[model samples]
Target: MTTNEFIQKLDGLFAAQEYGKVESFMLSALEEAKEKEDYGLYLSVGNEMIGYYRSISRFQKAYQISEDMLLLMEELQMDQSAEFATVLLNTATAYSFDENFEMALRFYRRAEQIYHLLVSPDDYLFAGLYNNMSSLMEKMDRNEEALDLLMKALAILKNYPDRQMEAATNFTNLGLLYLKTGDCNSGKKCVMQAIGMFEALDTPASHYSAALSALGEICYHEKDYEQAVIWYERTLEEIKKHYGFNLAYAVVCENLANVCREMERQGQAQEWLKRASEVRKRLEGENSGELHDIDNTAAVVNKEEKTVKTGGTKQKALERCREYYERYGKPILKQFPGLQGHFAAGLVGEGSECFGYDDSISADHDYFPRFYIWLDDEAYEKYGEELRAAYQKLPRHFEEFADTVMTPEAVSRCGVWKTTDFYHRLLGRQTPPETMYDWVSLQETRLATVTNGEVFEDCGGGFMAQREVYLSYFPEDVRRKKLAARLRKMAQMGQYQYARCMMRGEYVAAQMALAEFIQNTGSACFLLAGQYMPYFKWMHRKMKELSALSEVAGKLEKLALLPSQQDKWDEEKPERYRFALNTADEKVALIEEIAGRIAVELRRQGLAEGKDSYLEPYAAEVESRIEDPVLRMANLV
Candidate 1:
């Protein structure tokens, strides 16, 4: 078939909404194009497939197809051509969706270079490029640069009367950007204009839904809960009609719940919350992979007799431990009367399950129905081995789930251990830190682990006393010193060095600076909340649980994951440096906003003296308040 005929057939299937059949049809077309040695037809079919997969949120497939297209383009020696540039733009978008921001920026830069060499200043292709590139810049927290490029796209799009949908979309984005930059009046005006355009054009439901949602967000921000509910309800209807129970539907439900709660409509708020939770649960369940039972009998019984089943309900490790203990541990301890009043039993240390954050994926290793039994040094010397032997003789299976096969090194995590030895292994000393230097040198994650989980029983009271000391959090002087150090790092890396690196076209260095800034900012937030930050892998998860700066976790995540504007920061083109500088300034403004929040918490806690949005002054103030001479004189990292 001719390429035109093939494309028409595909369009017909899409118009009919036969999405389930679309992938197979596209694959058949791609195979036919390949067999005929028709490279042009193959490219056309492949591009259509990539767009389809991306729309369906199958990002890995989209990315793989993009890679294949790029390889084909290279074999055809079409690197410098307009078609190659289009493919590069598509590939960059796929990379962005896959959260590979560095690679996304590299491809975007390559595409921009080719477009600069081949296209006119006012070409429609440049308008498309600017629109897509602006989105990446916005994701990267470069709001000012995003606004500029979006405006440029809107101006060029106005020259084409047939591109009203694209123009309206740009207006919607520009409004959101303006709101982000604190231009409330301009933001509302732009959004209203886009709403008018969308209504006039009778565009797809998603377009109108987005504009409604934007207005809903504005109303919610302005404390107009009633109006926010009205807008959000309208958006929810549109989303339900077009997209059903997808992520957008869940988000709108959450928005409505928040608005209802603010208006003190508890019943309505709970209804929305329940709906959102149900949608999210269903979505997560669909993606969690096939479930399997954990029967230890498979190891001993005949393989043919063991029935492997799918879709077993997985229990949290902590819950499983409690059940196992109730069924066997309490009875087993009764058999050893000498160990009765000398031990403390609980689950803690060295795993996500200890922090109550474990899921099914955690059961792959070092997970089982297990709990720690701590004994006083004398009690341990007298009966530790005997108690452990009794514990091991208990059943290996509970509720049809088997204990995980642990590595030799992990055996120490459970069973009987001398109380002193446990503290020594975790904190490197038998007692709590005595000096400010000692306190400051301990890893916050270690402190967090030692104090996490529940003490199911502590008849001896020794382990509980030591655990309570650690649970009291850091001394005031040591906390001040650590907070000061984190604040200094945030100021240096986020507010200062990140911008400097961008201006000098050190893209990789810019990324590193931003990463360090995020890390220190997160640590500072935990310190403000008077909570020890957990391990690096669980920091964001734990940050969400903090009462102070709870909202900051999402903002920090965005700053870390967003794609940088490498296209504008190209050192080879001196003309773009000014624009890159503006982008960097925009990011600095975001950093300052985060710093302002931190400063508010600091002032509230009497930890610093400052009305300044910059954190360096606050850092200095905090450091000066550290009364410990040694910590006060220590280097501020």
Candidate 2:
């Protein structure tokens, strides 16, 4: 290609901001420049490539180019000139971009010396140098020196108003300097002037985006929120349309989200932050700090920090499990690619630890900062011990908090376990049930325990997917059967049997019947509410907390507190004879009253069809609603 045409093509690529194409053109153009023995053109084009690399944060390449150019200059007997100063300045800025501040300062001083030797202090080239150095000084907290440098930059830039891009950059840096010095008014004016200049131009879209961002910050500081929002939106649009989603786009998104939040547009604010998070995640994956930057703001109400600080909560345990999965569990699969999809790690099961109810006292035994890692039976046989050993290497104490005294029986409770046994331990079956009769006999407390906690990583999808099936609400027929069984037992023990024992003056036996009555009736109350009961120790407490039939809890409490009908204050009475309360009729009446209340709740729920206070009649109504014919044939209690 001809020289003029080739240079124009390179210019077009640079203007398009296509750095890959720019690099390619420079590589070919360097050969062409060398072939024609055009030293001036070669040096100029090489300088452009170096600046382009620095612009895109490719600092190493930019530094290498400067070294190559210096060698060529020495070989070609190049004179000391403005071009040499440009190369020095570009190299200095490249080092600064990489945060090699010491190296950057050395190059900047060298470039300053070269510029002073060859040019006036008032020249635009010298002006840009001061602006660049000011930024470095500002980062070092040398604010006074940074301010002096920016003022010097503006003094030179004001002499060249037609240098639109240069003037805009000087203003941006000066405004930032003023901001650093706490001169908010001066900062706003400088930033606003830069934005006005940038908006009036059509070329140098990056200058416009930068100027817009500066205006956004100034307006935000002034509390002119509407203007800040407008400017930030414009800057974001420019970045997306011209430069794609980069670091600048993410920053603008975060600022816009913050502004929207202060304006009480919570949903809009969270959405913007979420968009910013997604962009960061797409660009850098889990390796990016940018994702962490947006996480707290991106959620509408971030509770993680709150829950983490309140240590020993269930959330704390879940967080620990999640951290473990992200650390050891995920990395193990990454290193052993064959193990991917072979096993799963999570917190689950009916153990108190699984439910996160184990406090300091309860934690003395089986509680631990541990979770289960489940595998299919085949995987368990093949890689079981290997994977278990891997988990054993994890820090024994999570954050210096020791777990319980673990034993051989507790091994499968928290570590790598077979899926069949994991389910069977709590669920009493190998896999998910196939029929209504299977559901008929499962304990409700077991259901609650199995479904209570979080699952951290389900790579295999085998273990968690099975749990999903278990979480499904029981079939209408199975629910009715379980409800019917509970009702039948409550009626036999509390309503019929208790009264029968009381009428026979068997008050001691009557209390036993009353205790059975309370247990069965509470179980029925939980069934009627469609809630699984917890373990027996917490059953009464949990039942009282249920939204449905909770008042029945109060009645059961009164029954337990009542004095026995035939025996009272026997130790305080005569040695041969004891005092009697003769409250058998009152005790029987309370039993009937509690049982009748349950029957009333059942009929109200349309789970039964009866008006009698006796619960046995309602059991038949409950059984009739059983949709599964085979399950309906099962025994009531």
Candidate 3:
């Protein structure tokens, strides 16, 4: 076939989604190029194959093709040529996606050098290089560097005003980076600018939809629920107008639902939730992959943004862990060939990181891209050490990450481990606990940690499936019993004792009572939702995720920050003390009001029944509803 006809045929097959035919045609063209000794044609065909392989997740083949391009260039004695630089850049990209940052960076710098020395600037290549490098730096927890690189990319696009779509993308990246750094104002500004640019230009719906969705995220985090709704609505408008029902549309729909739920507007939330389901059906029809999860509540960063590198939240850590598995661990196991099905891979432990609660501050000691490979008995005895060696030899620096500091219990983490031993260490028994007593007695926080985080694969050994069952939570009676006790404590501290302490002029004791009340209410909310209370660090943060009484969380936070009477007592005499006392009294009333709201939720759930405003009566009513004979007969406290 003539070259033009061959190119047209290849394009037709690609447009028709006939991947098999496209691959077949490309292979024949590649063979012809090699036989004709046309290095440029050979490289062109190889690059197309590389893109095809990457689109299909055949990353190993993608990297291999890039390697062959370099080999052909070297054989032709073409060093320091623009063509060689293109191959080098392509190879660097393949390595970057594989999370081998050291090699990727080396090649990227080399390619950049050649581009500067031997080639005129290609606007597309210049903008893309900086963009991809910024992404890599972001994954390394080097936010400042990532931001700098993105700005550089934006600078490049600015020179080419027709590249408005590319500029919008750069703006979106900047917005997300600013948000990652806790600069919500700057994040919102950049994202809004991107939205404006995308709207002005004839860009794809995704460009503008992403920008609007990011604004929604910023407003949601700032607790500007009305503004969040507006931003999310704009995103929904864009998606429906252009893309119709797709994953992004579903995501914005669900994001709107979450904001409405948080604002105590359940009817609106429900409407949006149904829209989300419909969008999911459309997304599924396109085989776009599994449905994305619910956007994480403020207690965690948005799961949709997990790939953005900033702090080390447990969610981010899990995402990083998955990236590592797919890039390094999975490929290594594939080399084992015959033994692939004899193992499982995931993160399992009682650590805060395991619970997806680790942040950048907590990550200072031990937290990053790490996971366990659990092998079967036979696999453990034979190939365990070899697999461990392979893992050790895998790329140590992924993205911008530095060498990991192995902790004291090094062998138990981020390496080849036996599944039985892993479970025994985390849960005190092999596999998951099978009895009610085992579930009840074990610390719920530990259980949450053990069952949280992603299991990339179980290699058909049933490990992932059983973990799913363990995550379904304890028996209904146990949840009610726990909720009842927490409710009783909240009533005693907030509804009963706080006001009494204030009345007696025991100012310090009153503050302590307020603190305890907030704690009880926070824990009670988690129990009410049948969720395990996370560690104390995440208790108040996670409390806001409970749609039952999440509005109370804001009040609880204000109560925690209330000034003790002494601050005013020392500054002035009677008047200041009176002012402090009045503030304390109002806080106590607010706490009680929130307690009543919790009582309302309990009654709605049929877990409590009473007309009494005092929380103690409602607590008693809830205890009476516990169905388990043993738990129901147990003491209220």
The lDDT, on a scale of 0 to 1, for candidate 2 is 0.70
Q: What is the TM-score of each candidate against the true structure?
A: 0.50, 0.48, 0.48
Each prediction's whole-model lDDT (CA): 0.75, 0.70, 0.68
Candidate 2: tens digits of C-alpha lDDT, residues 572-629: 2333222332224466677778877776656434466565677887888888877667
lDDT of 1 at 468: 75
**Whose TM-score is greatest here?**
1
lDDT for predicted candidate 3 compared with the true structure: 0.68
Per-residue error (Å), model 2, residue 410: 1.9
Error of 3 at 289 (Å): 26
Q: Candidate 2: where is the Cα deviation over 4 Å?
A: 1-328, 400-403, 503-508, 567-589
Q: By lDDT, who's the top model here? A: 1
Candidate 1 residue lDDT tens string, 1-637: 7799888887676556555577898899889998998888888888887766654445556755766676577667786888888877886776564444444665688788898899787888888888877877887677888988998998899899888777877888888888888887788888888888888874353567878898898888889988998899888777655444555667887898798778877666656655665565554454353212112211322222233332344556776787677777777777767876788888878888889888767767777678878888878888878888988887766673555767875787787888888989988888777777778878888999998887777778278878877776788788889999999999999877887787787889998999899889889988876778998989998887664576688888766666666654454345654353344444665787888878866754446656577789999899898887777888733
- Which residue pairs collide in model 1, if any? none
The regions of model 1 sitting more than 4 angstroms off are 1-314, 400-405, 570-587
- Residue 26 local lDDT, model 2: 83
